[model samples]
Target: MTTTTYPVRVDGALDDRLNRWLWLVKWVLVIPHLVVLAFLWIAFAVLSFAAFFAILFTGRYPRSIFDFNVGVLRWTWRVQFYAYGALGTDRYPPFTLYDVPSYPAHLEVEYPRHLSRGLVLVKSWLLAIPHYIVLAFFLGGGTWFATQNWEWSVGLVGLLVLIAAVVLLFTGRYPQPVFDLVLGMDRWALRVAAYAGLMVDQYPPFRLDLGGDDPATTRLERRTPQSLPSASPREPTPRMSAGRIVTLLLGITASLASIVGLAVGGGLAWLDLGMRDSAGYVTTDKVTLRTSGYALASEEVTIHDDGATLLRRLFGDARVRVLADDGLPVFVGIANGADVRAYLAGVAYSTVTSPGPYSTTYDDHAGGAPSTPPTELAIWRTQAVGPGEQTITWPIESGDWTLVVMAPDATAQVAVQADFGATAAALTGVWIAVLAGSGGFLLIGMLAVVLAVVRRPEPGPSTLEPASAGRSNESEDIH
Candidate 1:
């Protein structure tokens, strides 16, 4: 066999005493791991963003960041191996980010001391497109079968795992061929993940090395004391403390929130600047108001007593424009809720319960029509009457208010198309402040996280050599 190896190695050894029915409940058992993984993946995204810049300018991934990222991948692989990815083992995965040697599943990525500065720009997105497409089938793509009446969807790896689980359930053994195929697919996905994550500069070869052991596992070691006279094992990478992990995660979450706030703030600024008319009024689409009664009235809208000056600064001028559908003289007015009720008392009218694009509903009040025309009423604070299109502009104030639209002659039937507008002068400044504040927070949070992740810990001592004298140079480097 051709011995080709990639930097990312994923291995999973099958358990000798496999539980037959445990696979069925593995989904329920893996819930805690999945919950923790969700947060870890978010932190992974934040760290990868920082790593991109570091790799771009320095041609190197920070050693501390590299180790932490590898730990995340290792943790994920162990969980996947124990659960659905291969169901190769029944041993539970540890909660820590560091690897456990006794665990059946392991992932190791050889750290690159120097990466290609130019390749870092395109490898993750533009160069990795082909593998992403291939993985779409292996991970998730389409339904297994579909008909007019029913459909069932499953990915290739999932189907294989299900088959193996069923076989193990009845025959007391997992199919080795299926396990090998699953391992190959999982390894392929992990390699792509590493490359696209900017952890490696080498392109992942489009070859499947099927089996539990990696193809690079060929070198045999002579571990006898006489055979290894000159060297000791390489020092293990320091593990990130749980407290540091928690702090990093909090920073990442804050940065994500800042980005979302910036986006929303930018959108509001766009609307405020680009959508207003010459009079500084942003208007809504015309809504048709119709009623088979003397008038159509809006629901009681309460304006809190926060002072008229503050209200004016917030809402600006409130304007309502009405156009009679039947080309009749119409009257539209805004009055206090109590005044409106006194005027419309014992008068047949509909209070618009809800207005929507497709349907409008009303709460009907049963009585006779008004005795006088709406234009002659003294209750209206602001009114427009006798027109094809009548407009009313009123300063916003603190009170319970209602809008009433009716025929000027108090006729039973009324139909009109109306639109509302407001000169919300405060929005432009509000959005600008939001953009500046969130932008600052985003930068600060990112800087804090990067600093924390890249901080180098103090080296304790050298464990790679024995405490004896006269060590010979004939031993091979264990790397």
Candidate 2:
């Protein structure tokens, strides 16, 4: 009996001995391969796009383009196998696009002389959707249209390779079973890739053919349907161990926690930016005070609302300073619009001075005495004696305010200096904390998820009925 062959074939052999620490550095070693592959893939995409139009028109894939694209895939596979892709080989991948027979990793695709003009338009995209969905879980999910900015998960195959690398690191032996499963996945992915690349017409099978060799090629000699050589009939599907399940669950939880932490940290950062002060102010406004008995001078200054949210207003701060030249004592107080008006209304004799639209000055004969005591909204107050200065700083809220300067026993000339500013360093600290915490959590979660997926259990062994029984029944019927 003649056997049929699959057009796409991918195979690899695990190195007998692997350097325990080499896997860690393979990422660095593959930089040259990566740089070259980057350009090759770009060409591969352009050529593939061109091939699509060619197939659409002529019902034939150009042989030269097909070979070159296949070579790109082949080169990529070898680098992946040697490094994070499979960790099945320790041999450094060569830089060439052509096949190296001595290299443990190999890939090939048979070119078709003719293709269906109708299928060419849809097969690579529409008809291949099912296979694409399956491959997403194995090779990492990404969008077809926005491939340049593709976001992919750490897929099952990558996770499995990572597990193999770690095992090799500790025990110095690549686990055969793990390698077999990883190879099977790689084969499946490549076959799909070939089909989508327009190299073959046959659809990729959903079956998991675990081993270094292609299962389809090996099954050709047998007349009966091929079954898994080691799977048991009772439990055909693979079962993950308890430890692996626990690990996956932990990974999932950690990922969720990390995502939540990122949100909270971002919110904190926004709040800090909105509330914290980024600039400082030093205002030196001149005011004259009468040295005669019971004299007071006041200046009304507008504190414009900066449109900050109520929470930010509640948390902000402003510092005020009052200085006098007469070397006597001065009493300074800040009162709101209503309090300033009522204080001036009750004064027996007073002079009013208007500096700006938002401010008004008042001279009082009662030494700044008010008909009623100051309101609680009076935000700040201080006393300056002699050449000494008075300073008061407090959390600021938004409103129109008045600066009241009064003579304490004697009159004087005063220079009122007030400073207001924000704590920007606090905002920066919050932002850094958010970024570092979220980034760290995300990194750890991704690693854990990959490891958990890789360590999942393999499917049970399959049982096959004897092929001779059908032959014997036919012989009995003939007799």
Candidate 3:
């Protein structure tokens, strides 16, 4: 728990060969791949839309929305594998057809690369940040916000991918090139699992008879089992250390708990920024007097409400706003709308006021909770002014405005909004590029998933035992 972290300087973060190939791989190869992802997602939307059409026109599902989503996820893993070099061709595990499965294989997978498992995992997850951006904008932007079904479908796919990557890390299949406390614990867990699974008849590699007419199996003259030389002293197999296993389990728990804490804290921060009050009209004192601190909110609050009563006593234009100063929260508004009920999303949303004009600003995540971590996220200025005056004013000159999203105060809002818009637009654009580039490589990836699902090789008959035999084993074990 020391704040200091040891740093190891190396010639390169990856193999020299990979570094040399980075140009070819990233631009030429990766670009086409991401372009493919972009188009593919576009295609997915098209196919889904067509599915709806087919349901109407032919009374059949052209494509199962569920199956299509599953396929998309499988394809994602395949591409990750290609990036990982875990398997030949793609990440889709080799398929086997069976009435009942015999051996276990991962339905979800992550690539195992030497000690660089954490980095590998980072690459896998980070690659899709771009795709998520595209999906967010394409799905959520435009005239209408994305439907809940659409949100759930994409969200579930993302969740599955995350779970798969986490399992891969905890299995110790992905090595930690850097000394990862997280992975070190996982190594101990894997060792313990290996021992426990082998405690009984876990991995019974059957001895096979040396076949006739095989040179590799040159047969010695037959001898009785007792004729062999006195057995050399065999090394005793080591049992899993109970102390180490306990320590590892605790480590895993701690790691998970930390992640959950960060997520909750970060989510709350995002909510607060999104629900701030800017319009400065609605007075809690006034509303409290009218309905004893309560009034029924309408489904929609427009410029004018029904009848003669104004929603809030405001002199100028009605506005509601929330802003974040470093890690803290503040709310301001004129006529607080009925939608306040709906604004109780995550913590970040709680801080949001009305949408501002000009460009996108990443909601400032002012790091952790009260008296917490140093801020990694930058801060933005928050202010309000009278009508026809600038909410934000640029320092370059008195009359200057940056870019216009919108603001009651024009001059100051311009400079700040422009800066935010530039940063946000760049971030969004990068994410889109990543999606498009990754998609290109993922055409090969999609093929892998489809083959695994649809073209799996049938297992030989002996590979499976009949249900009666399985039942008999259960009975004997019970007895």
Order the candidate numbers by TM-score, best to worst.
1, 2, 3
Model 3 agreement with the true structure over 371-422: per-residue lDDT tens digits: 2111211121223333332233211111111121222211111111111110
Q: Give, for candidate 1, the lowest lDDT window spanning 10 residues.
A: 461-470
The per-prediction tally of clashing pairs is 0, 12, 74
Better of 1 and 3 by TM-score: 1
Q: How well is each residue in 1-479 modelled by candidate 2, as lDDT tens digits?
A: 11545767787888888888888988899998887676566556556776888988997876556655776798899998998878888899876555665789877665565888777778777988998888888878655454357555888998888888788878998899999998998898888888888877877778787888776632211111123333344532333456754664565566666767888878767656554433432233444333332334445555556744442443345555556555555555666756666655644434345433335465544544334433333434433333457655544556766555554432333333333244333455666687788779767765664464342232211111123432344222110
Per-residue alpha-carbon lDDT of candidate 1 for residues 33-90, written as tens digits (9 for 90 to 100): 9987876776677788878899999998877677667767888998999998889999
Q: lDDT scores for all predictions? A: 0.79, 0.62, 0.26
Name the better of 2 and 3 by lDDT: 2
The residue ranges of model 1 lying beyond 4 angstroms of the native Cα positions read 20-28, 141-153, 169-172, 216-237, 284-299, 306-313, 322-331, 336-379, 385-390, 404-419, 455-479
Q: Rank the candidates by lDDT, best first.
A: 1, 2, 3
The best candidate by lDDT is 1
Every model's TM-score: 0.75, 0.45, 0.19
